[model samples]
Target: MRNDFSNYFNNSSENKWYNSSYIGVSLSIPVFDGLQKRSKSRQAKLEYTRTGLILDNTKERFNVDFKNAINNYYNNKTNVERQNQNINLAEKVYVETALKYREGLASMSDLLQDEMGLSNAQASYLNALYNFKEAEINIMSLNGEIKYLINK
Candidate 1:
């Protein structure tokens, strides 16, 4: 009886100790949380779409602006060239008129008219040069190379 009682006590103590050292792993899957996670995911997706759309719109606007800038640059370049030609022609005419006036072949009025034409041509050339430079700056800006152009 004593042995049996001692063994029972020993077994009970061992069982208690073993049970105290128990380790358990549990997995908890969320079933419902007021749809907060779902809402956050939806919001994130919407923000992503909005960002993409903004990027696309900006790209389109940039393309259009670049095209317009290029067109203006070319137009101004042609105008500058035309104005330069006009200046050259006007200078030649003025020279010819001055020679004729000295030889008594051209009247003072004709010589003055040629001088006025030359002056007008020079002014137009300067204006065209200013416009061409402005257009060049615009082109450089549209190409994102304004700094480079300026530095050069």
Candidate 2:
């Protein structure tokens, strides 16, 4: 019994401890996953492309709208200037006609006509001013300065 106990306890192979750690590298390539990974990759790529298209479309739309707003603003500004000139001309005509009527050189009908022309010119100027302001607001909106308009 003593020899058997000594053999069991004192054997080098049985009593020795071995380190189990090891360092190694291995690569595993997928053979088949029911095409789920492929489908996911395809979906991701499609979404990326769709997003790019949407971004481009948005940019085009914004550019067109901005151009239209600018055009409208300039047209309205010109109209306002033209209307102002018309108002000034009409005022001069009315004053001259009034003086001629007082001197008995212009008929009452001529004076009335001049007054009507001045009134129409003033009304047109007011309308043009309103349209110009509206166009200016649109321009400000397109330029993303709408906040300044609100503050004003």
Candidate 3:
């Protein structure tokens, strides 16, 4: 609601006030915008769902990588232990072969074969150790950058 009032003057050497008054009233009722609101609501819901799916996918991927890192770490640890055992057994065999060769009960070829076996076992053990270290690094990396940094 609104109103206004004013005075008019007649230019006849005399000023006079005339009856001039205005009054107004207004009311607004809105109509729908061709389902624009509904469309925006649907878009918002779809965007929320898409965001949720993306979050779930990222979590699943991280889980898979973490599991793989742990598996590799355990497998490498086993390999290193096995290789160490092999080296120990190879050293014993080599020492026995050397003693036998000195007593003339074993030939030079037997001693040489035992020496080569010992060397191969040592190399395999080193390789296994290296693999174990790599797996450990992978696991630490998966845990977080902070852990890897701390270790470094």
Candidate 4:
């Protein structure tokens, strides 16, 4: 009676066939063929190794960019400081030259030169400030710090 019941279930239309006959054979053949298995394993290892190297390169590149941005910011800051110093000196020179010209002791050309120097210094200082801000932004981007600042 048990055998009849088992046969009935095995032959029933509702019974789902897994078709696992080829599954074991397919799995065992790769192991039996040592060359194929070794080749596949080597390929997978190589792919993983390559992925690690790529990630390392990306990390190193970001580090380099961050360092460069830092250096740029410092350099721009130095430039701005120098420009400020120049503007201070130019102001004194411009004031003295203007007084001298009013007393007819200095030429108009000299006063004009002093004014131009002051203007140039002011422009350069503003440019340096802009550059410093941009460098800071770049560093933030490289460090992945700007993500929080994004609206999305």
What global local distance difference test value does model 3 have? 0.91
- The digit string of per-residue lDDT tens for model 3 on 1-152 reads 12222222333446655799999999886686889899999999999999999999999999999999899999999999999999999999999999999999999999999999999999999999999999988887877875758888
Q: Model 4 TM-score?
A: 0.72
RMSD to the hidden true structure, all candidates: 7.0, 6.9, 7.9, 11.1
How do all the candidates rank in terms of lDDT, highest first? 2, 1, 3, 4
- Candidate 1 wrongly placed segments (more than 4 Å): 1-31, 149-152
Model 1 lDDT tens row, 2-111: 99988887877655543356689999987889999989999999999999999999999999998998899899999999999999999999999999999999999999
Give a tens-digit lDDT track for model 4, residues 19-38: 55543433433436758878
**Candidate 2 segments whose C-alpha is farther than 4 A from its true place:** 1-32, 148-152
Q: lDDT (0-100) at residue 140 of candidate 4?
A: 80
Question: What is the model-wide C-alpha lDDT for candidate 2?
Answer: 0.93
Per-residue CA lDDT of model 2 for 84-152, tens digit only, reads 999999999999999999999999999999999999999999999999999888888888799976898
TM-score against truth, every candidate = 0.73, 0.73, 0.72, 0.72
Candidate 4 regions exceeding 4 Å error are 1-34
In candidate 1, which residue pairs clash?
A: none
Candidate 1 lands at a TM-score of 0.73
Q: Superposing every Cα of model 2 onto the true structure, what RMSD results?
A: 6.9
Q: Which is the winner by lDDT between candidate 2 and candidate 3?
A: 2
